[model samples]
Target: MSYQALYRVWRPQRFMDLVGQEMVTKTLKNAIITHQTSHAYLFTGPRGTGKTSAAKIFAKAINCRFSKEGEPCNECETCKAITEGRLNDVIEIDAASNNGVEEIRDIRDKVKYAPTEADYKVYIIDEVHMLSTGAFNALLKTLEEPPANVVFILATTEPHKIPATIISRTQRFDFKRITAESILQRMIYILDQKNVDYDDKALKVIAKAAEGGMRDALSLLDQVISFGDNNVTLDNALLVTGSVTQESLFNYLKFVLSKDTTNALKEIQQIVEQGKDANRLIEDLINYCRDLLLYQQAPEMVSDGELGLLDDKFKELSQQINVTQLYQIIDELNKQQENMRFSSHQSIYLEVLTVKLTQLSTNSEADRVSNVDLSQIELLKQKIENLQRKVDNLSSNTVQTEKNNEPRKQVRKNTTKGQKNVKINLSQVYSVLNNATRQSLNELKQVWPDLMNMLSVTQRAIMHVSEPVAASENGVVVGFEYAFLCQKALEDQELIDTLENGLDRLIGKVPSLVLIPVENWPEIRSNYLKQRKNGAVVIADDTSEQSQDNDDQSASTQPTIIQKAEELFGTDIVEIKND
Candidate 1:
């Protein structure tokens, strides 16, 4: 006999042989035992979940002459004939290839006839969702009221596509995805029956890679068996599944957790050089992180058998990073996974992810510093209120002084040569400074990438040179890399509108734009600070002298927060507001 695949050769012949669908199998067997089997039955689930196999087994059980307790005796002539696909009474249809009104009409016309040899005639249609709309309509009436002793079985992976009218006329059985444990047990049984040498770890790897599909697991096992010359080993399983070894994943994660980007990149380079897929490496890392997180939360829940070769180092690493850091890493890796689908330069993203992971600990620390306690927040609020009161007093004095002075009528004049020109929106700049917060600014920065993604290619390119530097509730200050781009961006009303729409979609609010060139940012910011100092009363929140010292130190020791904000928002739209 010619070679047959293990999945085909070991196809389930009885409900008892089927794994991971006890509810479905038990229900069908009970229906047969009670002699209350429905005329039309619909089976739905993921591929290789045994929908078709269950349908076949049910067909044999209903027709077998020597059936006992709703189970088919395979030795019977009727069972053997159906199993061999030569039974005249039992018809198997592949709806994918023959999904047309004419084919269903033919079935509809033939279902009225009685069985030729068996007690009942059975029709098994696989992938019934592939049937055309008209074909489904044709099958509906016959399915609703079929001839006596006739059974119809319709199976599909996608139950949503089937028409409601057709679905209402049949008994629906939802087959679930087979569990890994069940799949492993079944594979071990088969291996033992065949007297094949196999490693338990190799079987586990196969089961995990199958992703709840028995046929897929068996097919992978068959390939591994052939590749290993009848002895299934862990190495063979990894080669077949394109899965990284546990040691490699652990080492890569260890490098990331320890903030060793250089070693991490070297490890990735080695993996890539060995012909391993960059995407797969990322997937493995993400899974490892997930396992580590799970292990941390419920150590007893996670078994080494299920995860396939876990080491004590995973638990140690879990202890090294908190849950928040692990969640952030997983989220970033997931985003990279999505990016990999669209990007041809997957390795670049992988390298970028490695660097990002190494920085998570530092970023978390910085976040802790920025997220002050409630008492500190209340103190900051009281100081802001005090400053507001001082500003009010200063404003009243300025208004009285202006009223006391005479109003001068000025003549309209044009600027001449050698005049230093300054163009700044003082009112808008003041509003942003008054309302700015580390939290709101960080919020905008977080969604900036998403906003950019929503923009058209042209708009993104036009606005790429700019970023949000300072943000208020009602407005944001955008800094441009080049003065010309800033000028152009201001002139392009359509681009601004697109940005507003994109902001609304991504961040749920849009703010007014305050565009300034990077070259002119320092001058503009200095002028605003000078105006605030000259026009407002200095309160004793942080002594005026200390505030000045802090300002000078901030400028000298590091860039001002505004400068850091400029870098973060990037010469683009810095912030957005609802109004």
Candidate 2:
């Protein structure tokens, strides 16, 4: 006589009413029809997957006097009483609340009784995993061998918590999660039966949000229906589901693709102000990009139900962003999502994420530029001309300096008040450049960006403004654009480790890292070249006691190749054998 929830009103009463579990339903139905029903059964799956509903249907079907083809006839008093939960022969228990030994003992004591009004007595226990050890032990023997005309059905979302002995006693049926398509169809059928006007997109949104749970889908549909005044509209559905509209997501992503950070942040602020959760928004964006990528690879695989509408705008956006760019954006977003999990200042992280995404998009666009483009060719020509002018100016300056016999001003680190200064070991730099070959430097440069991509967002941002300028067999000299970033890179040991590990994978050896400001890089390279031109071999001077001791130790002990391999690859990767 009162208004009931949609899930409650439309609860599956028969095996045929259960959606997205044809195999489970068919197996249960065949068992009942063939009169070969097991005395005990264990049903396991995610919630809203129709485990309990199937159990009830099975109970009613086996006891219904007028049952046909293993289906319960609702007209019979037995099926009607069971469906209404008034049948004395059918019992349903919540193990979560009554998960003690005493409660199980009570059930164990009652299994000897015969059915009062039906041919068989059925017991359905939901959330059976919550039963304590003693309670499980108490029920194990009874479940293995029940009285005649008695059946027990145990259902749980987590089957792993059930002991192996308890699990071995019953016939286990694993229910699968319902698909979004199946949920959408079920919602449409319900809405049509109720004659409620609903947008197809609205149903799709609810279905995707349900994540394969029919009860959740119906619950969300109920909320949307109530919010929409019984009219399931797209806006109402999005509001109820706390989902970003496809249009809004498309617009935000468009700004990101265009590298428009200002507009993108503006869009994000609006979305957050509207009360959308940060983690949820990030998850939706990831899914949206995943759908876009799927569409890019195979348009037919992505349907309207999965990706809202998939209109002309969606197609156009997919065309604009290449697969590689999508991959970069997704990876960056996933990293940011993980970072935001424990973060209190989520909005700040989101702002930072927006900037990173736009930067990635810009980098990807630059990478896609054609090598034969006239603009790039012009840019290269200008750079070459500038280098030539610089060379000529240097030549003139050198002649003047020689005439005056003046020493060139020493290129030193420029430190200002409150400015952090990164200490670059000049001796180390000299050594790397001393042994640096063109081949090593080129190889480092080739894999630098790829290595940077493997780092976390903060590390990547700091390292992106740097380049591998010179490298040797044992070390690399990276030049950062700013002194602060250079200092940050020097202090971040994790970043250093990640870079070294990534490099080891990319190229076969792990080289130590040396960082310096880009402002001083040209001078450093120029000074090193000048010293080499003058036939001055630059080498690291051993000044520290540790260095002297290390040299002494090396002189005394000759390390075998196995020791070197162990040092390079770690002891775990190297094995030694007796000769």
Candidate 3:
């Protein structure tokens, strides 16, 4: 007897025998039980998921000589013939080859006939989408209003090409991929029955590589297994498929997260040097990222299919890479995979993809800085605020003493014939100035050492006199220094009485009055008589004698205030009377 491959030997023989297609099987079973079977059916979905098998079972059940509860009794000759493809009443058509209008016309003529032996004549058209529009249209009329005791079952991997008219008249069943668990369970059953030695991990890898197709999984197992071999291992599975382990991809991701470009590149180099498929490597990476995303969202769970083989460590790593980064990495890997098709340097494309991934590792540096936990930022802000408070306390504790409230007197230099001299006590004047003006005055005083602590400094004023006036009859006029001009103007009303009294009390005479810029002093007075008229005691207009008289006045004024105040308060306070 010739050998039968695993997939053919394992083909589902009944509705219940089909794996992972319970919905279709159950519906078909109920339909058969109720005798509510449709004349035509369309089964569509991914390959290897049992659309054709379901169609066959439905045919067998409907045509069986003796049926029990809508299930075929294999004991019957009619059911056995249909199952073995010997019955003329049940016909399986490969629409791919018989897809022209002429071939369909032959089917159209056949639909007119009555079944010779079976209760119903069934036509199963596989890959019906391959039929041309003319062929589809030719068959649509008979399909919509088919003869009694006739059934049509259309199957296709791609159904979009089938016209809506044909699809609507037929009952449609969309078959889905048999899930990993379903496929793996089936694989285990087959291996056990075959007495093939295998590890669960190897089976899982094969199941995953099949990607939800039972046929693909079984076919893969056949390729990987040597029937006489002791057992299958993860390594043998990896080698047969040219696929990398999820662990390798996970380690590459760890290197990527840690920004270990060198190690990541070296790993890729190792695989590239071994001549492993670069595109498959990218595919493995993308799947790895997918699992990582699942890990983060769904807890530490993985597929019993392939993920069961990986240890808990890979699962933990899966949780570390979140969906966002995983998506980004997969996007990059996909782009690199696309680039590899066109580029001559396949290894370089993979390297570039890894390098781009590693660059994202540095963004974690910025993340480290910005990720300063809210508590840390708050702590630093609080520390700054505390230091500010400390500074405020120190400043508050430091002492500052207020000066005396005595009027700030402006000093006046005695005018000699050839010298220009003017004076006043600054301290007395500043005491009366407003706060803002006092600050300006202090700043101005910095340029003059004597003025810094002095009561005042007099500016010689401008005056015009048409006639000479008696000294005792006129009151003395005081002009403020330039820096205090605004202060002097603001307090001009305040100084009237003080000036008049001080003139009489200190000089013992009411000198004639004038106020002017200090620069205009010489022109206001010519000699002693002119000075008395102008409210200045200009003894002579001669420049030489002016210097001598001014020297005598300073010698007298400094001692009276500084010397006396020094003895009284232990602080220097100079007083200069402008009168």
Candidate 4:
């Protein structure tokens, strides 16, 4: 026979053999023992967490004639046939390739027949979420009312993509990621069984690199074993897994925490030049920092197998850095990590990250405060007192002037004189009011806050004092509490465009903006109402020839009839003339 991979050779053959999935295996074993197994089972979790393995084990245990306590005897003919994929009753389907309506219809047709040699027929579909909508519908009826002595097992990494109806009909078991400790122990067991001399540190690195997948751990271990000529060493494991050694990470962090930018950049350059992945390097740093934090909080909890990066040097470094500095470092690294995802130049980002980390201060604010000079504190106190005295003198002077000169009325007059009036387009305001409806006004009000949130801070501040008083399909008249804000809002073209786009997305169309002071709005409305009561047409008296010329200029700037016709058809067929 050809050389088989460790993952294939070490595939879990029984419920007890499927490591890191005790809950799923225990429930399945009990279900088989009690004869309470559901006709349909949905196994969902991350890849390599034993979803398919558990399904196969359950199939064998239930079908084995010489089973004991829900455990299959591999010696039995049925168990051996299922294990060797030669059993007619236990079928395994890769839904990724055969996910079609016709394929599922064939299964539906065959489900009625009894098993050929076994007590029950088991169908295991892997990556079941890859099934088409039509296939899902086709299999729905069979899953809903499966024939006697028939079982359907669906396995998927992403259960959310499966339709809710199919999920509801099956008993679900969610497998969790295997812990690092369990993976490390499993690797040790396998290595000892093979009589391979291995360093425990190498096994630790391989387990951490596996990131909770037994199959991945075994695969990595296989590579490391082959690379080391059957001896699993730390250097070989690190080389195979592309993982940074604990010492390298500790030295890099030491440079960073000591504010040694030169050494830190050199370390990063060396790591990158060694063909270490930028993402993996950053991830290792992040994990190293997390281990330092954990070690600081609970030293006993930090073991050699899990977070093995926390060595004695790491403990000493953890003491040098405080909790606050760790938080800032992690936050900065995380932000840079996100930026590195979309960027093609990762080495430049890594260099920039080195500079940022080195520039970060190790001293917390409390430490700085404690080291402050007493003389400087007294000097600051004197400056604050002097400012307070000046403010008090100005307040007294102002109060005296107000009492003597009746300054309130004078100040009001001066304020009114200094404030510039924003000229309201009364004609446009009247038109909007005439066509306005409660529904339009309510719609504007509903989306007002969301629109405000979308604007920049300065734009939002300008629009803060404004409210939509009347609205129509074509325009909205906004009443501002202050005249200055109204004036500022009218002048901001970017703000106007932003509001138009935002409102268009929310309420279906953009409307023209009309700005006026709140105090002026009531007076304008009252004047228009009085003119209507007196049987007079309400029109702006400022409709002079210059205004008409301005309107004509604006109209001419708009798309002309010929231009619009060209747009509707094509510019190739249209002609323009200056005359």
Q: What is the C-alpha lDDT of each candidate?
A: 0.78, 0.83, 0.67, 0.83
Q: Which stretches of candidate 3 lie over 4 Å from their true place?
A: 227-230, 273-275, 300-307, 319-324, 341-345, 361-579
Best lDDT goes to which candidate? 2
Candidate 3 per-residue C-alpha lDDT over 228-268 given as tens digits, one digit per residue, 9 for 90 to 100: 26466777887777788766777788989888999999988
Question: TM-score for model 4?
Answer: 0.63
Candidate number that wins on lDDT, 1 or 3: 1
Clashing pairs in 2: none
Ranking, lDDT, top scorer first: 2, 4, 1, 3
Q: Flag regions of model 2 displaced more than 4 Å.
A: 304-308, 361-579
Q: Write the per-residue lDDT of candidate 4 for residues 385-455, one digit (tens) a residue.
A: 66556545655774576467554432323113233336566768877877888899999999999998898
Model 1: per-residue Cα lDDT over 37-74, one tens digit each: 88889999999999988988999998887888889999
Candidate 3, 304: how far from true, in Å?
A: 5.0
lDDT of 4: 0.83
Clashes of 4: 0
Best by TM-score: 1
How much does each candidate deviate from the true structure in C-alpha RMSD? Answer: 19.0, 19.4, 20.8, 15.9
TM-score of each: 0.64, 0.62, 0.61, 0.63
Order of models, best TM-score first: 1, 4, 2, 3
- Determine the C-alpha RMSD for candidate 2 after optimal superposition of all C-alphas: 19.4
